[model samples]
Target chain A: MYIADRSGEVIYHPDQQLIYAGLTEESPVADASLSDGIHKEVIDGIPQLVLVKTVGYTGWKLVGVIPVKNLAADIDELQWFGVALLLFTVFLLAFVNTHLSEHISRPLSRLNLAVKAMEAGKENVEFQEEGCEEVQHLAHSIQSMVSTLRHLMDDIIEQEENKRRLEMEVLQSQINPHFLYNTLDSVIWLTENGRYEDATRMVNALGKLFRISLSRGKTVIPLKDELEHVRHYGTIQAIRYKERFEIRITAEPDTEGLYTLKLIVQPILENAIYHGMAAMDEDGEITVHAWRKGGDLYIDVQDNGLGIPGEMLDHLLDESQPLKHSKGSGIGVRNIHRRIQLFFGPEYGLEFFSEPDEGTLVRIHLPALNEEQAAAYQKEGTGYETKA
Target chain B: MKRKHKNLIQLGILAILSLLVILSLFIRDISWPEKAERRVEISVIVRESDSSIWSEARQGMAKAAADYGVELRFLALGESNSVSEQTELIRQEIKNGADGLVVVPAQTEALEVIVKDNPKIPVVTMESSLEGACISVMPDNVWVGEQLAAAIEEDFSEGHVLLVDAAPGSSGIRARLEAAEESLTEKGFTVLRCGADFTVETIEGVDAVIFPEPESAVHALQLLDQNGKTSSLYVAGTEERILAGLEYGVIRGVVAWSGYGVGYQAVEQAASAVLGKELSEPVVESVLVRKEEMYEIENQKILFPIGH
Candidate 1:
């Protein structure tokens, strides 16, 4: 509030800052000198409700400059207060809902994902125990159930692995007696033909083959020993068939210490002699080659003889089909395929490649294990079979 | 924490804070003690309330009263500037529920004493200050003297100037007389003085006269006119006779201070004091007028307030 005289000189003002600073400009309220009333005027861009009163004889004006908004300041305060209150409530509700959802819904979401993973057959899925007590208890219960289920599954797998080992052992036992019967028959033929030297060599080869096949009651042996067993079996077969087929056995120097399932090659050799070469008019050719590739061992047996028919060859190593017909030692090639899978894992098995009238080749695939690794393999039984 | 408990806590705190805010606003409404419903009544005590000299001043007071939403009562003090009568009026107005006072002090000392005695009643003084007035609306007498002296210098290089002084008890009268004397002396003039003991002999060697008060000017002019003396006069008023004297060459010039400003600012200060508005001492205007410019628009506004 200030007072200005007739000539617009500010004789008195409430604000001394302006007077002391010598601010020489006339106030906008000076215009109030024109009359004595309330008037609306703008000062410095702000609309003011200016009330002017003339000092009676002096023509001085007393101006009360009130901002227009100040007139309704109470109402404005109420409106702002209401708006602020509403915003605060909404914010508070959102905060509570967010925290509640995090406490209850978030853990449930994680639990749902874990259940999905379990349904999808992932056994090593990481489980989290969190959120409210109910959710925590649910998670704990599920984790326990999954733990017990895994243990039961493990027991089933161990039983299946032991059963497979027993089956392979029985198959090996059947192979041995059958091979002995065939060799004894061949020995009798040799002795009756007055081939005493060949009979002695056949008996000696049989002794060495049987000795190596049952080496310290082990199912796995060095490739060289297996090769030696193969050579002795080849000698016996040569004496029995009167050199009807020539068999060449060769192995890479790196495969010397690599071991394989015992008695694996001898049956294949027998099948090559009786089923593969027996029908060939011309002398047959058999090639046995062993080599190491990556961490695995490969043994290929190729026979240049009457190739098995395409339809029959397709089922030769198919374990899903039964080997209703058997030849040589009464052990079908499919049985040997199953024995390799059960003993060394499905990835290590026999693969047959043949075409009609183009000879047959059976590739033996096995993990390349030295002596110490083979012992671990015998102890562990088998890698869990993920046949799919 | 439980959801139910947390909600309760939040609501309780909000309600308490809201109640506190409402309570504070309510307390403010009650504790401040509202002013009375009736308009404030201010008693103005002057020498003579119906004097023509107060026509513009009364109008100024009326306008200020209307602006401040107060009421004014210009009390009649008979035809005299009597301290006893003015003091009796002040006491009566106080008893009659007058919120404040505007005193055209009859005697500065007596009024100051009265003001000190009635400390609760705010008083605004005009033209004089002794003590305890919330505000004093006075004139710049030195400027008035300078203006009058400059007017004389414009007509004459030097002269024997008679300074008519009155109301020795009033500081305003003393200040005006001293200012005029000092200014005229600075102009290398021969200065003479008149007081309550004045006679025609005091005007003997005087080439011109300066009256510092309106009453003194009026009294001196009537005496000069009665005695057929046409000595040039410079008076401190825009009274009718002073204007007439200026027109007819009896008065060379008039140094009239704004009488209206004194009344208006005095009432304003009084109203502000009782109404709880801040105030400060104010100075009213004093203008110089000669016969040549007295009829001009701005000068006419000052000298003749009723028109234009």
Candidate 2:
């Protein structure tokens, strides 16, 4: 809507001289007054609203204008739709606060690693009592304090294994009277030299080695009756060491029904025949061996002879030292390494590999139990009888 | 905190309903204040200024006075074809303050007493009218002479038709040459009323000449191309020299109108009778063109009167 005239020249505009090329100035509506209303101005920089009037006596005014951002175009489209609904409600509340902190920190981080593995003592502290009820009452009070510290550590380890099985039955009745006084002194020197059939085959191999070292009070046996009691103590030490040492038992047939600790390989085969073949004379050897692996049963023994000296094989199992040439009670390899760590907890025991004269092995270890876990460890007295 | 104060009062009621829908779209885009645009001035009093058909009806009255923002002015009393010099140029355009007149009436019965002595100035008469003119924008001249005598009786059914006749006292070109001489004498075609002469021996044995008048159909196609007359001409009128004599095949058909829609409906009926509105038809249509329907869009808007 325009009409111009006085000296501004644009006789009439009606929308196109480059859309009112800044209303080619009537000095910006020259204080618009021929009388009508609205003035405001600005033009090229936009903000218009003009209106004016007067075309009658042809002084030619008229005006009309408009622009002010087309009157705030609907409040800038409702301020961009309230800033896009406040950024889609802040991205849907950051996706529901990351799914409620991963559903409350994933089971409270698995009950904080089962209470840091029960503060590191770790006796099986399983947790997951599921979450939120105060974290399932703190994982059911740490699984009832790890089941009351594993039933008070299995009642103080079954009263220290009933005082070490009554001190190993008084050290197996003092080793059966020193092995029946060395097998009745080799059967009174072969029945007074008559050599009664080698004194009845050394009294039937010392009556099958004292009926398998007094089996009735069994402390555990079966590796085929512990290799048939070391083959009747190597046939009375090969008729009392006459053949100068060669006891190779080598068991295995699936470790003949497993079980172990009863005079643990006959005190490591009497320390490999009195301290490793008592200073081997000519090719003295002692093998024993036994097998079954991972679930542990291993025996070993080994002994080529005269081996114990890496400074006495570092105190040869140190039962507080006492082994110049221990022939007996020096507590054989620390009492079979404290009865295989008092029954397999110290990861089974005895490792001694020797080397002085190149052979000494003695590996031991234990726990392959079988026969219904050796009759449930001999009715829970931590078991021992397989003397068949 | 009470659901974060009910999410900040529902984001303060969606920011106060988006600022009351942007303050009702800025009060519906600046409410309503701007009205005053009633200028009007219209004076168009032509008989024939420099007649290219009155300069194509003053280019449709200067495009209806630049489309309704009227102030037009055109006065050509056609060099005094004097009816008191076109009644003293409509009394000096109603004393120079014409709120609307649009005349073309050199003598519609002597300008119907100067258009009933300007009954409050809103005149509007074009090719002839004025029993007190307020609307006349003419052109259905007896339906453009009965559609140019039914397009010359579909090309001369019987011969001898030479009807030129419209320049005497122009009673709208003598009522379109008496409706193409009573439709070429009822189609038996022996209607010869000639005035604008075309002589190849006066259109030798005329089978058709009928130039009702676009300047006598360009003076009868320049007297039938200077008398080498190959007769069939039929023009009623749409002058760009009668559409260049129907694009040089020397005019075989045309019964047109729209002298730019009678000068844009005589300045939109003199600006709707000076804004008292209501005049959609005071006679404006007429068609029947033929040099192959002469570029059709309604005969190229009555043969390009300033290209519409």
lDDT of 2 by residue, A1-388 (tens): 6666654444555422211222123442363443567877785577777787766777777777777777877896787667667666655665566567657777898898778887888867678777578888888987887787678668667746654864565356446677678778988887898888877887897787667777776766677886787778778777777768888888778877777766667677877888888777868888888888878788888988767778877877776787565565444566667666765555677888788877788888787889887766655654221121
DockQ of 1: 0.04
DockQ of each model vs. true complex: 0.04, 0.02
The superposed Cα distance between candidate 2 and the true structure at residue A3, in angstroms, equals: 11
Residue pairs with colliding backbones in model 1 are A56-B60, A57-B260, A58-B260, A58-B261
Model 2, C-alpha of A141: deviation from truth (Å)? 38
Model 1: per-residue lDDT, tens digit, B1-308? Answer: 57568667766765665555565445434644364455788998875444666766776687678768888998766745667787788888988989999877777888888788889999887766658888777778677777777777776788898887666656776777788788889989888887745555565447787877676677766777778777777887678878888999888889875565566677888899998888965756668998888887556656765410
Residue B50, candidate 2: how far off, in angstroms? 5.5
Docking class of 1: incorrect
Worst window of 10 by summed lDDT in candidate 2 chain A:
A15-24
